[model samples]
Target: MKSDRPSHEDFPHFQTLNTRWMDNDLYGHINNVTYYAYFDTVVNRYLIDAGGLDIHSGPVIAYVVSSGCDYFRSAAYPQVLEIGLRVTKLGNSSVTYSLGVFAQGEEALLACGQFVHVFVDRARETPVPIPATLRAALEPLCAPG
Candidate 1:
């Protein structure tokens, strides 16, 4: 059952991640749970660095409302991975990010996934419109129709 995962070229942003020894399971491949961590890392790094998301002290913060992944192949410890990221949808208070994980320098995808984040007021935890600066930063990554 091979997954028709999206290719690396489908994404606009990329981050390289090195697999740790502990990431491997008894079968010698990286554990499935670790893939979710990679997804979270890339998304948060982009938000903090490019979108000016103040994780600690901001009027609004994004909370993950949903996430899912499809594995195409297995990856092992010590493999360098290129995590690809793109925005598939941008709504008033929610944004959906599509991601692909590939072996570094390879064209084939090892995994593909998506996660939805809903922005909300930090204090009240109520949904709020995405801030201007954050929206501006995410625009470039939006997938072309």
Candidate 2:
């Protein structure tokens, strides 16, 4: 179904990632699920650093409610992955992040997907407004696509 999709430049923002040895599958290429893991790491790492999110003791935390990906090309071990990231939408408690995975310096993506997270109070296990600091950090990445 995804074979007919257009190139990743069709989206916004770009973050590059590298493939590790452990990301490979029995078939010798990167496992499909590892792409999602990279997407999560890149997005969270940026948010934590830029947004000042404290995962251990922060009052606010984001929970992933849904995520998905589409493969356009095969990525193998020892390759540098360039992942493009952007906030497609920011709701009261939920944010939808779109990602495009490319190989090294390539301009096109090998995979793309959206990851949705619902911010919440970890103790109460319910949705909550995104913290001001986090919102401030994410503002730069929210420009319309």
The candidate that wins on TM-score is 1
Best by lDDT: 1
Model 2 CA lDDT for position 27: 94
By summed lDDT, the worst window of 10 consecutive residues in model 1 runs over: 1-10
Instruction: Please provide TM-scores, in order, for all candidate models, with all chains considered together.
Output: 0.95, 0.89
Tens digits of per-residue lDDT for model 1 on 1-145?
7444566778999999999999999999999889989999999999999999999999999999999998889999899999999999999999999999999999988888899999999999999999999999999999988
Clashing pairs in 2: 14-84, 15-83, 16-82, 17-81
Residue by residue across 1-145, what tens digits does model 2's lDDT show? 5544445554555566778899999999999999888988988988888899999999899988999998878999899887877887888888988888888767666888888999999899889999999988777777365
- Model 2 stretches with alpha carbons more than 4 Å out: 1-13, 143-145
Candidate 1: give the clashing pairs: none
